[model samples]
Target: MAVTRQLTGIQVRGLLGRFDHEIIFPESDEFIILHGPNGVGKTMLLELIQSLSGTLRIPSIHRTPFSEVRLTYSDGTQFEVSKALQETLPLGEELEKQIQRLIFRLRLPDGQEISSTAGFDSEELASPRFRDWASRVLDLEPVGPDIWLTTGGYTISSLELLHKYSDRLPTRALRTGGGKVDARILAFLGENEVHLIETQRLLTLEDPDSSEFRRGSTRTPAVSKVESFARDLTRRLADALAENSRTSQELDRTYPRRVLQAHTEYPSEEKIRERYSEQNELRKSLSAISLLDENVGRIEIPKKMEPWQRNVLWTYLEDTEKKLSTFSEILAKVSLLQEIVNTRFLYKRLEIDRRRGLRLVSEEGTELGLSMLSSGEQHELVLLYDLLFNVQPGALVLIDEPEISLHVSWQKRFIEDLQRISRLVKFRSVVATHSPQIAGKWINRMVSLGPGTTD
Candidate 1:
């Protein structure tokens, strides 16, 4: 079941520096977003909060175990962790700025100290009590390299930041390896796993067609069949029937987790080999789908937006075109590689060819179709991949001025569709945009940040 998150608060310390203005806070949600114009300290705000956990610069913190920090969270909480630096012991330490650790002291319901100053390094390391409230509260983790940070003289690129600290990206991630799975497909698998595990146990019991799994006395399926049965029977439950079956099966397989314990050694030899081969095939298709998906997110651009966006998109698309043109006979195969950017007449030989056509009237028509695809065709495939990619969990999509390179209709319609799909797929998008219409789609999550914002 989809769960709601609490609006618990966080106190940030070791900030490179606190924001001069108060940072806003929302009561509850699985994720939080921040955005703003250049120099508004959008990056700074994310860094400050990220520091509260771990993932960015430590030694360059604005404050430290060393004291005094700015707060960007809410106005309500039973108690907050307050502390003063032990200044007296730093007679000659040069006031270290690096924060090696961020320790959060929690006040228990029984008014007891959960720790005697002995704390864990990360949130996961924190005691069970703290995790129950904090883990689900923040749920922030690094999705991949698209992390954006400006702390410690570092420029975090699109492949460097994640809202949550999970290794879910193509790089080195946990249990989920880089198998060419688009982010969305990966998420679908996870949701399926959650539902399938339980459905297996009960579905087999309800329809015990195979006597191989019958229990000694009861009509229960065999231990090994439990897992397979759930996966099979759950697969049988389609969209509408899924909910009904999931509900009933959930009750039947209430002890699904416990069932996993029965298979002491894991999957049988035959099934293990079968899975290995199946996984290889899945990865090949997944890679192609992911490559095409990056373009779909491009559809979010608004019709009436800023100029920098159009300029960026134009330059990028033009550059790619020039390179590909060199391989074939495109417009006498313009020598883009030989052209100079600052030349007075860079486009001296350029002509508006919006009405251009590719003529291939022969058995080689199939070959011509491959060589002369229109820009619009490329854009559509990109959008398709983007649509598929959003179904994955913990995706951090960094879209820079997403309002360019396509029709206005695609921009509007895809915005609404993308938002709905992203949520179901476990994605957290951070876009640098100027379109109010695009921003409106993600209104509840808007966190504008950039330079000129104080810290």
Candidate 2:
């Protein structure tokens, strides 16, 4: 039997000064179409489900500050979540602390009230099934830290947490082997891959599958390889310097003043020469100089880093490993992200080749490869890339406005493709568009965003 999560009704509280609000989700279709103009809280409604399910959340940018997030279903199953948002006070005062704190609350069907991160205990919150829902699905994840939460689904926030269970991971551990935990999480949330985009993106807590490598290198991380090279370089430089310093001081009175490195035998030879010197003054100076230089040589940094600097890699690796292994879904996203990056790379290659074939590549080379293609073709390629980011099946997608850059024919075709993509990946989708052409050619079931009425 096909797994389905029927949305009967929902209630939200502590959000945008809304103590409580009830939304009756359309029951006929598997997707929920939240219609609204620019300012309405259609996106906010979508984020609520994500927060409750441990999926990522797209924080509100406009008005209606999302303070509390709560939801309820037809069967009275509900989820309560609390969020804390506010800047901290410079001065330390207990009473002023509350001013800097914002909290959200959600009530689930079982009467369980969830507040902020502190409100839910990890022991009670960790569920193997949530891990499952997020695995193998695609369609929702943030392009950057600007959007919090990594899982993708409805509202660019809600995780159509995959309810389906498979043997890819263990039922209790919910992870394959800690190597792909992040990918596993993506699979459950209806997205099974992730991509790291933008030039000079931070390597902090980033996955290793990013396809944008240093042109041609092994899949090994750029940072790791560079670090190794630096270490070897440091050692070689230090050795060469030390050898020169020792040879310089081994001369007689008329000997040309030059530095020489201390060979392994230099320590014993220097003792013998000092005993036979006319005065101990020159001998003491030479020995002292050699000692000072040797100490400096000892201070030389590793080829890649200083000891202090290298320590960061250790700490970062430890923390990343601990946090990453807990979520098996992340592995799936990392795999998919690699594919997305490769696609972008291919697009770039195609553009470069097209431009070199004799055309004005100056004023027109805005986005490199993207500039060579027609707008429609570019949009289609971009859509495919976006779709690949969420490669897992059985996901629920809510699209606010899909006709932004599409044409009349593309609107219809894209909608059909969107429908087809869901079937291939096992997902459910809802789209909102203002294009009358799309409306005429496509869907008939649309929930209007006009003023409220008891329809």
Query: Which candidate wins on TM-score?
Result: 2
TM-score of each: 0.30, 0.38
Candidate 1 ranges beyond 4 A from true positions: 1-33, 47-101, 106-415, 426-434, 441-455
What lDDT does model 1 reach? 0.32
Sequence-dependent TM-score of model 1: 0.30
**What do the candidate models score in CA lDDT, each in turn?**
0.32, 0.36
Off by over 4 Å in 2: 1-23, 26-28, 44-52, 56-64, 73-76, 82-371, 441-444, 450-455
